[model samples]
Target: MRVLWLSSIACNGNTHSFLNYPYMEQFLNDFEFIYHPVIDSNYSLKEIVTETIACDILLIEGSISDEFKRADVPVVDIITKYAKIVKKIVTVGTCATFGGIFRESDYKDTTGLHFVKEVKIDKFKDLLNKTISLSGCPVHPEVLVNTLYAIKKSVDLQLDNFLRPKDYFAYTVHNGCTRNEYFEYKVDNHKFGELEGCMFYDHGCQAPFTHGSCNKILWNEVNSKTRAGLPCMGCTEPTFPKSNLFGTKKNMGIPQDLPLGVGKRTYLTLAGITKAFTIDRLEKKLFDD
Candidate 1:
């Protein structure tokens, strides 16, 4: 299948993320890459519009803009023209799938490709069947690779309400986190770079509620931001980088955000019971030779 890739209003973070795949070159062999922003294929903005690229699949990166100019052409119009001919449409990043960080500042002028502020576009109603959304700040390479493989194999994929693949989005980042023990014990990491406590309580981590397999699959194969003592940042969620990202959300000195579906009262009660036993093992350094 010939895949056409386009980007607008982005820093090419997704492209970089995909490049991190250890076997990116081998994995890409399955499909015929006709055009991409940074990879093998090359095409200009004018060429993308005029040339009849036999595109069976279309992958879009970055947020769309009805106001901004690119190569003297409106990006939204470019997307609309291509969406008409492609058999499958994939929104590759959070910006393309759900109007990410950029939309926060210029919401009225900027929006995602298929959906406008999470609302599906009327003109694209017929194209919904072909649309696939892979949302993440800089989308996971595995997700993109797996999705492409599935498409190449003609396998039927399941998707959630937002059109995200069910397999990847079914589990939250908390499902297999290293700090699960700490979370169970209600132990909170007061500062960054600690390996002994859960980050949900006081470190601004959103692994429990947000969907994605950051913990299970792991980032860079060995560590994630959380494992290194940094917060999850809730990059997978539509409302990422929630206010005061540097600080935790608290209610009366306690964490405001609970695990995915755990009730506040239940969580607090469980927290109280767990905090009673502060294991020395978790408090000590993770690595000691």
Candidate 2:
């Protein structure tokens, strides 16, 4: 398969993150790269913009903008050209999928390839069927690589409303979180760098509501934000880079965003019941300090 990787208004965080993939050398061997910004490839940026290149998969990184140019060629023009022929279009990060952090600058101008923060982009509405979104602050290397292989094997990836592969995005970040028990008991972690309490109550952990395989797959194949005592920032959601990320938005001691499918009343009742009893083990340090 041949891939033409392109970027628009972006920091290239996804590219840097992808370089950390343990199997990158093997992946490069399998896929023929027609043009890549960082990697040495068969073709240069000048050729990609000037000539018609046969590409099977078109990987777009960063958010899109009308003014942003690559090789002095408009990014939208590049996408419009290749989007017509590419078999698949993979938006490889939250920025490319839903405009992410860049959208905060100018919601009208900076936008995703197909959708702008849940709103579909009419210009590329015709290509929605062939587009796949891999939304993350900097998408997990495994998720991107695995999806590519699935595409190679003709696997029909079931996507969600966001056009993200359901196989990876279906699971919530809380699924494999280590502090699930603490969350259930409504124990809030008051301070950072401690593994004793759940961050959902106070530290703005969005694992319970946000969907991703961060906890399941683990970042760098070792630890995740929650595992390291940091909160899940909900970077994969359409409304990423929300204000005051360190503090959970609440309404009179109740969280504004409850766990997925869990009603506010039900959560309040459960929280009251859980708070009635104390789990001595949870209150004590797991190991002697």
Most accurate candidate by lDDT = 2
Per-model root-mean-square deviation over C-alphas: 2.2, 1.3
Please report, in order, the local distance difference test score of every candidate based on alpha carbons: 0.78, 0.89
Shift in Å, residue 92, candidate 2: 0.6
Global fold similarity of model 2 (TM-score): 0.97
What is the per-residue lDDT of model 2 for residues 156-206, given as tens digits with 9 covering 90 to 100? 999999999999999999999888888888876547878678889888999
Between which residue pairs do clashes occur in model 1?
none
TM-score of each: 0.91, 0.97
Model 1 lowest lDDT segment of ten: 104-113
Give the per-residue lDDT digits (tens) of candidate 1, residues 59-158. 8888877775556777767777778888788888888887787766553556676665457666556778888889888999888888888887877899
Q: Which parts of model 1 have CA positions greater than 4 angstroms off?
A: 105-108, 116-123, 287-289
